[model samples]
Target: MTEHRIITIGREFGSGGHEIGNLLATRLDIPLYDNNLIRMVAEKLDIREETARAVDETTLNSFLAGFIFEPIEESSRLNGTEYVPPLTQQVYELQCDIIRKLAERGPCIIVGRCADFVLRDHKNCINVFICADWEDRVERIAAKYDISQRKAADKIKKMDRERRNYYESHTGQEWGSIDSHHMLLNVSRLGMDRTVDILERICR
Candidate 1:
């Protein structure tokens, strides 16, 4: 049997990362695990999908600082704390587990969630980071969300900040930095099809 190709993509907000992943998955005839990963985790863990989405691919904030100091075994004791919810840690762990399992299953494209770091040891893995110019990103977000350019830009800034903090906090690596990925592509430069072609070639 041939080893499956695994591609992990990390992208700046509104940089067409999800679209690229979808296209790549279609072109390669593999599953695209983007937001669906969150849904799967939520279902497996019996948690609300919204809760899963909130923390999905996102790092815990200072709000979780106190809990991290507590022993993992004793985490259940703090179930009722006003600052932390019982399912927070459970959801996070389930998400991580799902990511690992998906990679083991076969060829797939995983977008976001520090998947590159999670599967760093997988020999067949190829990690790519997608970014674009601020203006281009703003335009993409505006069109997708049907909001004004200024509002879109603001949303992009906020989302990217959260993603960066989440990635850095959990993986201890710089988000969108070249060091974190095998290839860094500016989606604006070559567009999605060319980017996918480039990645497919590199992975091959």
Candidate 2:
């Protein structure tokens, strides 16, 4: 019941969580951040957007940090080969810094990339998880992307898996677990506008 100024939304694939975040930001007259943060990370790291996105919200970030790169060993073996932290590690660390800075700057809506965990200490940040029934998720994704329900379901499965792995790896918490969020919203039931309205009231 604290006055939450920054909002972080963790959502299942195709649950309209992104849409809800955007609407909430608009209504609040604040910036909304999603994939845009990826671009920022990409630019800061001097890597292609596609490269940064390749590891975005996936276990590869941590996996590659410890396993995929043998830069230290390789450096000793090869002699004078500069060692850099894996790009995934850089992106994760940099993204965390960005998230914290954004929280400090002002109120805003941020979606995914483990923003909830990044700002867990913030006194006025609300972490929300958005979810929907599978059938409902498939319908929403299908309509939004103009794809068949079957394909939409497949897409949802893959994305949800990646996000789950990413969040669990970074936060040490189960993605979408009820305890992890201040509130769990079923956009399937509340719909986007009402969802925004409720969150808006809560943000007050």
Candidate 3:
């Protein structure tokens, strides 16, 4: 905490990244930004939280872009031409701005939402990527959601794909590439409590 480090955590689905972030934040006495960002973006755009959540960590399909986003106003048109960005893209830009401001403010932890890439230039930023064994992830998801293993596996695949697409599209980097992060952790092996302890020590 002496250096006011900014920690950005990226994780595979069901890897306990958010929970780890929450624990680290509590131990470090710093704020954590995760789903709370969805609310902030929702308020800024005057849209429902659900609407923001729908596009929070996914890219908008080109074919459905027009249907999902309204036309741009004449004054707001790019070079007098209709050039509306997808709602997902707009939300990302807004989130990037907000993330930058938060990092500038002080030490904190930001989970997912491509925060690592967003704060890449920050001098004290520590980017982490968390992954786990497939079976471990499946069990975690099933137990947490009270769903069948098959259903949990399906959800995990879908969520990870969306997160991968979103991150690659915006950052032009592999989602969990070792080159992109300062640390690559296997939470299943470390255990959530041990993972939190390690990260807390890193922050300190």
Candidate 4:
């Protein structure tokens, strides 16, 4: 607890990354941040939760030529009526600030939204990438959401593409690539309980 440990879980959709993170947090007795973060961000910005989530982990394809990027450290991180920078950039900065704040608060698990890249400089942070076989991913997705295998596969492809693009655009690293993470885990091979146990041992 004194070390301010932070775990960032970067995962493929339907790979049980969220479930693993939640279980890990429960076992470790710490907070797990995932989609619930949208509410926090929304409240801070005084915007609708849907509005905040609209840009969460998503990139803006619209052209913004010749715009200078503001350094993250310089962000005001306002909790106000209106956003300061372009909406996408503003949301990104705000999330970055929240992630840093959460890290400083103490040991916790953060899932997705490029948390690994955001806290890349934190000495106490461990970045993990979770993956599984395509079939395993598809099967998990279909079972959890009551969708057909083909639909699940389509969802997996689209989600993976978005995550890759989001990570690369924000962090300049290949998404789900081993080089980007301290550990690359296959939940399909290890199983969820064993995966959590392995991560616990690693963190210890």
- Measured by TM-score, the strongest candidate is 3
Candidate 2 TM-score, true structure as reference: 0.87
Q: What is the number of backbone collisions in each predicted candidate, taken in the order shown?
A: 1, 0, 0, 0
What candidate 1 gets wrong by more than 4 Å, as runs, is: 60-86
Worst 10 contiguous positions by lDDT, candidate 2: 69-78
Give lDDT per model, in order.
0.81, 0.85, 0.88, 0.84
**Model 3: per-residue Cα lDDT over 1-204, one tens digit each:** 234699999999999899999989999999999999999998887788888788889875644333345445512567867776767877888899999999988899999999999888788999999899999999999999999999999999999999999999989999999988999999989999999988888878
In angstroms, the error of model 4 at 50 is 1.2
| Native-referenced Cα lDDT, model 3 | 0.88
Best candidate according to lDDT: 3
Please give the RMSD to the true structure for each candidate, in Å. Answer: 4.3, 4.2, 2.5, 5.4
Instruction: For residue 40, give model 2's deviation from the true position in Å.
Output: 0.5
- Residues 114-144 of candidate 1 have per-residue lDDT tens digits of 8999889888889999999999999999999
RMSD of 1: 4.3
Tens-place lDDT digits, model 2, residues 68-156: 33335333333655665666677788899998888888889999989999988887889999998889999999999999999999999
* lDDT computed for candidate 1: 0.81
Order of candidate numbers by lDDT, starting with the best: 3, 2, 4, 1
**Collision count of model 4:** 0
lDDT of 4 by residue, 73-192 (tens): 544556753323656676777888898889888899999988998888888899999988889999999999899999999999988887788789989998988889999999989999
Candidate 4 wrong stretches, greater than 4 Å? 60-84
Compared with the true structure, the alpha-carbon lDDT of candidate 4 equals: 0.84
